[model samples]
Each structure stands twice: as C-alpha cells, then as structure tokens.
Target: MNLAGRKVLVLGLGDTGLSMAKWLARRGASVRVADTRTGPPRLAELKRSLPSVPANSGPFRDEMFADIDLVAVSPGVPLAEPSVRRALDADIEVVGDIELFAQALPERHARIIAVTGTNGKSTVTSLAGAMARAAGVDCEVAGNIGPAVLDALMRREDAGRAAGLWVLEVSSFQLETTASLAADAATVLNVTEDHLDRYRSIDDYARAKARVFSGDGIQVLNRDDPRSLAMALPGRKTSTFGLDAPRHAEDWGLLERGGEPWLAQGANALLAVREMKLAGLHNAANALAALALCRALGLPLQPLLAALREFKGLPHRVELIGEADGVRWYDDSKGTNVGSTVAALVGLARLDSKLVLIAGGDGKGQDFSPLKEAVARSAREMVLIGRDALLIEAAVAGAGVPIRRAASMDQAVALAAQAARPGDAVLLSPACASFDMFRDYRHRGEVFRLAVERVIDAPKH
Candidate 1:
C-alpha cells in the first residue's frame, strides 16, 4: 500500500477520482488524472483542489498508461475499458477509491456499516446513520451516497471522536476494486439485473455485489432475494430481513398482532408498522435492513425504532410531491433500474385506486419484461419518455392499458394529469437511468416536480 515514489494514474475526475488524487498526492505518490470527457464543469475546481497532480481531461492516450505503476479508476469509468485493459496487460495494479480507503482503514477510527444493492442502498445507509445519531452516537454517512469515503474518514479523524460510526452506501462498481474492506457490519439489501453495460451478465453483477461479504464481518442478508442469500459467506454470523415472518432467532420481519403489522425481530415486536413515516412494502424492507445493521453493530433497539418512526423518506424515491384535484403525484426518479421501478409499482398499487405511470429512459441494457405484471395491475395509463420508451412499451405490450408518448416532462405531466382520475396516483418512476433525457436522476425529478407545479397552478376551466 506504500505509494511513496510510485507513479499512479487516477482515471476519471469525479468525486472518487478527485478524492483519491488528493489523497495519493498527500502521500507523496506521483499522481496524474485522465478522463474521456473534455473539461467537465468542475475541472477547474478539481485542478485547484489537486494542484500538485497533473491532468489529461481529453481522450485517454496509450502513452498515458506507459510506465504507470497503478491505475485508480472511478466507478463511472468501465473497468473493461481499453485504458484499464492496457494497465492489466502491463501488469500495473488497478484499484479504486474504495480500495485505497479500505487499505487506509485497518486501524480505523470509526466502526463501519456498508450497505450495497441495486436499489435502496442510500435509504438504508441514511437510516442507519440516523438511528445511530438518535442513540447519541457520533455518526457520519458517506461513500456512494455523497461525500467520498476517504474524505469521510478524514472528517471522522478531524473530530477525533473515540466511538464514531460510518454508515456507507457502497456500489457494485466501487466494490469491484475493493478487496480488504472489513466492515463491522455489511449488507446487500437486494441484487437484481443492473449495470449490464459495465458487467458481462447478471451473475457477474451479483458477484460484484457479493464482495461486501468478503471480510469477516456480521452479514445482514435479504431472505427474499435469492441472489442476496446466495452471496452469504460460509460460517459468518448472519441476520436476515424480509416481508415474511422471521424463521430464525436473529432475523427481522413483519408479524401481525391484533390484525396490525409490526416490525419484529423473531417473535418480539419492536415497532408497529403503522407508525413508520415511509410508505410502501419496499420501504418497510429498507427499515428492516437498517434495523438489522443496527442490531449487528449493537445500537439500542428503542432509539433505532424511534428514528425509523420519525425519519422522513429520502427525496426522489417514492417521495410524495403533492395532491391536486384529488389525484396524488409521486416522484420516484431514483427508480433507475427494473427492480426499483417494480417495487414502486407493486408497493403503491391499490385495489381501489389506479396509477398513471410516467416511465422510460436509458435501459442500461436491462430487460424490462419484469415490469409488465406490475404495470398491468396498477397503471390506468402509461406515459412514456426518453430514449428507451419504445423498448419499455413493447415489454409491456397489450396489457389493456392505454399508452401515450410525450415530447417533454411538461407534456408528460399534462397527459398524465388528463388521464388521472380522483383517487388515482400519477407516478414518475422511470426504471432506467436519466442520462438519456436529463443531467441525472435528481435533475429529472426536479423537472417533473416543476411540471406538476405548473399544472397545479394553472387555472381550471
């Protein structure tokens, strides 16, 4: 792990790359950065932040790989890319920010709880941190969700807290480069088909997620997902979370008492499901996963349940925007994969009401067939947008539901509003990445909200 006098190349100048470059430079490694994109908006800031490290912001050159001792790739950059392949062929080590941070944390100041999945990772990570803070513990939440892990480690170090906890939302891409991340507790909430462009197949993608269980740590698994259970390490102490009743002593699940559902650990009821602020079955599973992590880390059950009851849900993941003319509007723009969208569609589906669903974007090489049943059961009408609109439409073809296409978010909202009736829900839960139509998922969510507001504010005839 010694970087002194080594020539290292940090590829892609996003958050991970920037943090890694600065960290490596501080450790006296001769660092250089390269990105295919020419002069990103924050390129000047990246240069200012890592003044000692030279950068190549344009196309990557083969000469850049020459004599490089190591290559640190950002998650956004595909590992199978030519530059990374060249590094491999040259026998130069290629790692990621997560690997660097993991190597640096052998005697870590903070206890770590790392969560990874195709969806709900951010929600679970935030909830775990909130629960810890509620119990009066010093906690920091970072990694894939926001601030870089190395920076988070630095922040924890600066505070010098004796018992700080780090709740990190790790991604499969990040896990690909990490080998020695020994978390105090870790969980892969659920793994489904995703990142097909970066991975060779679904099994390959799931294998990347399974890395979270590599270290000797308490593993929290999802009993409902076969892929999650398949990834469990042999002989590790494991706890599980699922919608069904818990069959094991350490598992978490829902139990019915007095005709009401309660979040339970084995047979013991921790909190009534009615008290939770988060809506839908998917969120209930997220809460269970978070609670399992809390238990593994020995956080107080009472405080964690209290935090779960009061915690407002994260934005853009089944977030309720508003209601107008008796129709509810929801923004689930973070449903950037098939599994996520199916969760939203099925979890929010009601026998008494209908859903006007707005979906479609970059398919990311995912098969959309899984969404058919959920869409058919809930959607009164489907409004499509973005690059893979036709692909999604064809996947759910002939469900007896009316389908329409929109040129823009504004038009989509108008059409959805027109199609929606009283007691219906207008949901924007595109099961694909937002890069096709917008800057990112957050941007897509914001635009949807603005469109809804415009429709809400317009005078009704």
Candidate 2:
C-alpha cells in the first residue's frame, strides 16, 4: 500500500478520479491524469488542488501508460477502453477508488457494510447508515451514495475521527475493479437485467455484483430474487429478506398479524408495515434488507426500528409529488432500468385503482418484456417518452393497456393526467437512462415535478 515515489495514472477526471489523484498525491505518489473529454467537469478543481500533477485531456495517449506503476480508473471509464486495455497488457496494476479505500481500511480500523444490486442500493445504504447513527454508532455513508470513498477516508483522517463503520452503495461498474473490500456485512439486494450495453449478458452483470461477497462476511440476500439467492457460497454465513414469511429463525421477512402485514424476523413480528413512513411494498423489502445488514454488525434492534419508522425515503424514487382531482402523482425518475420500474409498479399496485405510467428513455439495451405483466395488472395507460419510447410501446403492446407517446416530460405529464381516473395515480418511472432528454435522473424528476405543479395550478374546467 505504500505509494512513496510510485507513478500512478488517473484515468478520467470525475469526482472519483479527482479523489484518486488527491489520495495518491498525499501518499507521495507521482500522479498524472488523462481524461477522454477535453474538459472534464472536475478539471478546474484538479488544477486548484494539485497544480503540480500533470494532466492530459482528449484521446488518451499511449505514452501515458508508460512508466506508470498503477492506473486508478474511474467507474465511468470502461475497462474495455483501448487505453485501459493497453495498461492491463503492460502489466500495470489497475484499480479503482474503492479498491484503494479497501487496502487502506486496516489503518482506519472501521468495519464496512457493503450494499449492491441493480436497484434499491441507495435506499438500503441510507437506511442502514441512519440505523447505525440512531444507535449512537459513528458511521459514514460513502461510495456511490455520497462522497467518493477516498474523499470520505481523507475527511475522516483529517478530522482525527475514528472510522467506526462504513456503509457503501456500490455499483456493478465499481465492483468490476474492486478486489479487497472485505465488508463486515454485505448484501446483493437483487439482480435483474441492467447495463446490458456494457456487459455481454445478464449473467455477466450479475457476476460483477456477486463480487461484494468476496470476503468472509455475512451475506444478506433477497429471497424473492433467484439470482440474489444463488450468490450464496458454500460454508458462508447467509441471511435473507423477502416480502413473504421468513423460512429461518434468523432471517427477515413480512408476516400477517390482525389481517395486516408486519415486518418480521422469523415468526416474530417486529413492526407493522403501516408504521413505516416510506411507501410501497418494495420499500418494505428495502427496510428489511437494511435491518438485516445492521443487525449483522450486532447493532441493536430498537434504534433500527426507530430509524425505519422516521425515515422518509430518498427523492426521485417513488416520491409522492402532488395530488390533483383526487389523482396522486409520483416522481420515480430514479427508475432508470427495467428492474426498478417493475419493482415500483408491482409495489404500488392497488385493487381499487390503476396507475397512469410515464416511462421510456435510453433503455440501456434492457429487455422491456419483464414490464408487460406488471403493466397489464397495474397500469391503466402508459405514456412513453425519451429515446426508447417506441421500444417500450412495442413490448407492452399486447398487455391490454393503451399506449401514448410524448416528445417531452411536460407533454408526458399532461397525457398521464388526462388518462388517470379520480382514484388512479400517475407514476413517472422511466425504465431507461435520462441522457436522451435530460442531464440526469434528478433533472428529469425535477422537470416532471414542475409539470405536475403546473397541471395542479391550472384552473378547473
């Protein structure tokens, strides 16, 4: 782990790349940066913080890989890139920020709780962090959910605070380059088709997520997802969470008490589903996963339950935005893949009413056929938008739900409002990327919220 006088090349200049550069430079590593973009977002900040480090932009140079001892890659930069492949061919040690953070963990004396899956990673990570803090444990949420792991490490070191616990929301992309993150507790919440553009197949994607269980840590898996359950290794300690009743004494699940669902560990009911502030059955599953992860570290159950009861789920993921004409509107712009949209749709299905779904974006090469069953059962109408609207329309064409296309978010919201009945809900859960029409998912959610507000303020006819 000693970097004194070692040469390192930082590939990409995003937040992760910048953090890698800062961390490497502080360890006295001779650092140089190369980014595919002529002007990366963090270029100015890089110049200000570490002016002495050499930075080259636009088309990666072959010479950049020469004389470099290690290549610290940002998750956004694929390993298949020519420059990265060249580095690998040259026998240069290539790693990511997470790997570096893992290698440095011993000095910090912190236990790690790693969470990864195609969906619900952020929700589970946030809730677990909240549970730990409520129980008076000093912990920091990092990785994909907050500041970069290396940035968090530096902040904790500078503050002279003990790194009590680290709750990380890791993505499959990060997992590809990470090797040494031996979390005290880890979970692959679920695995579904996502990032097909980068991976050869769904199996490839799931295998990358499986890396979270590389160490001798307790594995918390989703019983409902066969892919997640299949990750359990022989002789390794395992825990499970699902919407149905728990099959084992130590596992987590839902139970029926007085004709209402309650969160249960084994046959013992802990809290009623109605007591949780977060909406939807999917969130209940997320809450159970968080509880399992926290409890694996032996964190007390009382504070964890307190945190779950008070937690108001993350924004842009099944968040209720407004209500008009007795029709509720939700912003689930964070549903950037088919799995997330399916979860949201199935979780919000109601017997008395249906959903007017606003979906479609980049699609990311996902098979949208999985959405058909949920749409057929839960959605009254589907309003498609963004680049892959036609693809989704075709997928759900035989689902018996009427499909409409819109060129913009505002138009999509209007169409959904028109299609929704008095008791129905409008859900913006695009199972695709937002790059086609918006900067990101948060921007897309904001636009959807504003459009809903406009419709709510329009004078009644």
Candidate 3:
C-alpha cells in the first residue's frame, strides 16, 4: 500500500498501463513503462501523461527487474512474458491495477461488485451500475468496462468520498495479476474457453476467473454453467442465477406462469421475461446475475428491475444493424471466442427463420468444436473470413451446412445476402478475435455495418 520510495515498472502502455504509470509516478513510485510492441499506439499519450518516468519501447528487459520493488502489469500484457517471469525470479511482486486500487481504498471502504466471465461481463457490469444509479446510489463503474480501476480510485479519493458502490468488469487477464481484491459481492457470470493464446489450458483460464471469489464476502455463481458453479468455495455465502426456477431462498432465476417466463427470486415473480429488452436467454442469465449482485449488496429490487427494462443493451453484441431483401442482419463483433458465438447462435435462433452465419478470424488457439453443435442446429450456411476460416470449416464440417469463404468483410456480407432467404437472419458472429483483418472488434463491427448498408442501399433487381 505504501507506494512512496517504491520502484515500480508499468508493463505495457495501453490505457490501463498509462493510467497506472501516471498514478504510480504521481504517488512517488519510481515508474518505468515498457511494451513489446515497438512504438505502441499509446506511446505519445504515455509520454505526455508521465514525462518524467523513463520508458522502454521494445521488448521487456530483464535488467529492469533487478531494481524494481513491484511490477504493475497491464491486463493486455501476458504474465507469461519472459521479463515478467524474470521479475518473479527476482522476488519482485507483480500485480495489476485492480490490486493497486484495492490497496488504495479507504479503510471504511465502499461496496464492491466484481463481475467476471467470458461473455456478458460488460453488459452485466453496466446493468448493475445503472441499477445502482436508478436507486439513487452514488456509484462508480470502472475496471475493464470504463476507466481503469486506479483512475477510478484516484477520482474517488479526489472527491469528498461517500459510502456507495464500485461496479467492476473484471477480465481473466486482470484477475491473473490481482490479489487482495475482497469484494462485497463477486460473480463469474459464466466461464468458457477464451484467451487460449495466453493461457496454458482452459482450466487455467477458469482458475484465473474463479479468483474473483477469493474474498470473504458473498459469491454469486451461474447455476447453469458447471465451470462457474464449480468455483463456489466453502464457508462463503453463495447465490445463483440461471434460466430454471430458483432452487434456494436467496437464488435468482426464472419461473413459468401461463406459458410465459418471469424473472424470480425464490418463488417471488419480480418481472415478466418479456419485459426485458435484452434478447436471448444468455442475456436473461446476465440480468439474473446483475439482480443477484444487487440483492447481495442490499440494493432495492424494484429499481434494479426498472433499470433492466429500460436498458437497451450494449452495441456489438447481438445488435441489429440493418434489414435488406427481407433478411435481418445482426452484428455481434464482440463474439471473439467460440463460447460467445455459440451462445449467440442459440440465443438468437428462431424456429421460423434460418441463420446465415459469417464467422472466422484469429482463432487464438481455441478449439472451435463447441461451436459445431450450435451451428448445426441454427445456421443454414457458414460464410467464413480471416485467418482461421478453414479451421472453423473443419470443425463444423459434419454439421451438414454449406460453407463459403470471403476475402473481406464486404464480400462476406454480399455472400450472406445471396444465401439468405426471406425469413433468414444474416449474423456476423465471428467466433474469433478481429486482430487478423481489422484493428479491433469495434472496427470489425463498423466495417460490418458499412458493408450491410452498402448491400441494403443498393438498387433492387
């Protein structure tokens, strides 16, 4: 907690790293910034933020670890880097910004709602914060979803702090370097295969996410996911969220009445499932997780449910972009892993409509096998793109669906339009990262929208 006179290295100059470097330097920690990428995108911003702090532009140097007391790693920097390992060997404690934020919290403390999972972390985190704001609670939503956790911590310190809530969207990457993060309530929405490039195995990835429950407070778990349910530790009060009826007094789930489902806590029906604007049963799980987190922190349910009804959902996740030739097109650029895309395919499946799926990008060393079953059930055809297109094709080969390949997003959209029928949905739910053909996922989604617009606005033949 005592940063003064400590020598710290801020690894990777992404937004989190820059914020951490600035914070540490301001607090008198001897800070140095380093990135593997030569001239990282944020290099200029980093220099402006902490001009006095020395920085390295290329690969990490082992020599830097010699004098460092602690290394604050940005979430994007993999812990497996040789320099990080060298730091560990040198007995230099390595931690992320979240850990630093935890160490900086006031002694009396504010309620912490830590949300994590492969998918819906952002939606649930945002939803929880909206719920708190709707209930008139002073809340800060940060961590991976907004400003860095350390930035949020500094802002709270600058203000005349009051007892409220801090809702955090914690990713596995952040969780890997975090310790001492004892939340008032924590939940891993659901754990599925993701970030296989950085992790040794799927279990390792899940283990990092499960650490969100390390605190002595309540653990909110996804009852439907075996991986998430397996993280419930002994001696911790646990609550659950899922599609089935609640099985315990404190559980949040769904109930069927008059052939329609309602969100319920135990036997009490809170709101009809139709009342929520979020699409898919997966989103229902996210809503339940947010509701459970709020109830765990003693927030009013009515206000939370009200916020849920009004929440329009985040962009790039099952977002409807345009309609053309009687086909509905959806953009799910955030579906960067197999689990997320699988969930989307099933969640958006309609009995009266077939799906023409556009997928493939950087596979990130993940197995596309899980996506096979869902694609077989819902997708009428698969239009592939990016580096791992053939890999996905091989995995979904036995599904009896026709597969096509496109050289670019525009071509993919055109192929999808050609294949789509009147009731068919054209979905760009790439089950891989966007780094292959685009700058990032947002760029991928933007390009998809532009391509769809071109298709829609073209002359009708």
User: Residue 263 deviation, candidate 3, in Å?
Assistant: 1.6
**lDDT score of model 3?**
0.88
Output the number of the TM-score-best candidate: 2
Q: Output the lDDT of residue 414, model 2.
A: 88
Write down the lDDT that model 1 would get: 0.88
How big is the RMSD of model 1? 1.6
List all candidate RMSDs to the true structure.
Answer: 1.6, 0.9, 1.6
- Candidate 3 lDDT over 136-215, as tens digits, reads 89999999997888777777677868548899999999998888889999998887888877888889999999889777
**Residue 120 in model 1: lDDT:** 93
* Model 3 misplaced regions, further than 4 Å: 161-163, 350-352
List TM-scores for all candidates, in order.
0.96, 0.99, 0.96
Clashing pairs in 2: none
Q: Write the per-residue lDDT of candidate 1 for residues 129-205, one digit (tens) a residue.
A: 99999988888888999899877776666677544787888999999988888899999989888889888998999
* lDDT (Cα, tens digit) per residue for candidate 2, span 73-170: 99999999988898888788999999999998988778999999999999999999999999999999999987999999999889989769999999
List pairs with backbone clashes in candidate 1.
none
Clashes of each: 0, 0, 0
